[model samples]
Target: MGCVSRRTQCAPRDTRFPRSQLLQELARYTWPGNVRELRNIVERLLLLTGDAIDAATVRQVLPGRRPSTSGEAGSGTLANRVATFERDVVLQELAAHGHRVTETARALGLERSHLYKKCQQLGIDLKTERTQP
Candidate 1:
């Protein structure tokens, strides 16, 4: 998050794009085109938006698309937003590695113990997730 702020500091003056909201919108989007298309969209966003770029700006930049409101971003306190993002990322990594705690921890650059603690904190039922199809 700090890194995102640092990078966006170099953006056009007064640009107020929040990284979590932006990331939420991006993740919800289904890119029909490839990396080049993503680059173009980002460039377009930078060029088109004024002082602040929030969810509405993102919607305008990507026409005909309505981002889901079910996402955990853009409607909470900062800590809740961060927790939601962390939970999603950890869940994804765990699923990707077939719920192997050590593998998931290594993939996320976390110690196995830390991952377990995180899962516990996030209320992620590993046994339940693992048992699911």
Candidate 2:
């Protein structure tokens, strides 16, 4: 019932918030902000709390979806287009490698650790193409 400023209170705390209350707060929020904003918020929270976050973290960090690149004069922005292309490529390579991270990294000419981080950043599900036994 106090001031519900997500910028301040939702900045992450050692104290855990109740799941129900957090869900309600998230529903009431109008977070038109995109994935970038969510990423920044999550990063800040991670640094602040030094702990793992869960679904309830959604309340503390707003839900965001990147805007679509539709009906633009060209491809919205060069940087965004490049990122999309790169993500697609990584996903393809991952699929081709049967979701084998080490093999995918080698094929992409990347270090395994670097590929892991890149896949995380691109929001690619690393287990998407698991090989059959």
Best-matching candidate per TM-score: 1
Error of 1 at 112 (Å): 0.6
Model 2 alpha-carbon miss at residue 125, Å: 1.9
Q: For candidate 1, what is the lDDT?
A: 0.69
Clashing pairs in 2: none
Q: Candidate 2's residue-wise lDDT over 1-133, tens digit each?
A: 2223444365546545454554464456665776555456545544433333344444434533223334553465788767775786686566656778888787677899999899888777666546332
Evaluated at residue 56, the lDDT of candidate 2 is 41
Q: Candidate 1 residues 6-111, lDDT tens each?
A: 4466686766677788767766778787766666666666654434557665664564473433454268877876687577768766776798999888767789
Point out where model 2 deviates above 4 Å: 1-73, 128-133
What local lDDT does model 1 show for residue 95?
A: 72
Provide the overall lDDT of each model, using Cα atoms, as 2-decimal numbers: 0.69, 0.57
After TM-score superposition, the amount by which residue 18's alpha carbon in candidate 1 deviates from its true location, in angstroms, is: 28
Off by over 4 Å in 1: 1-73
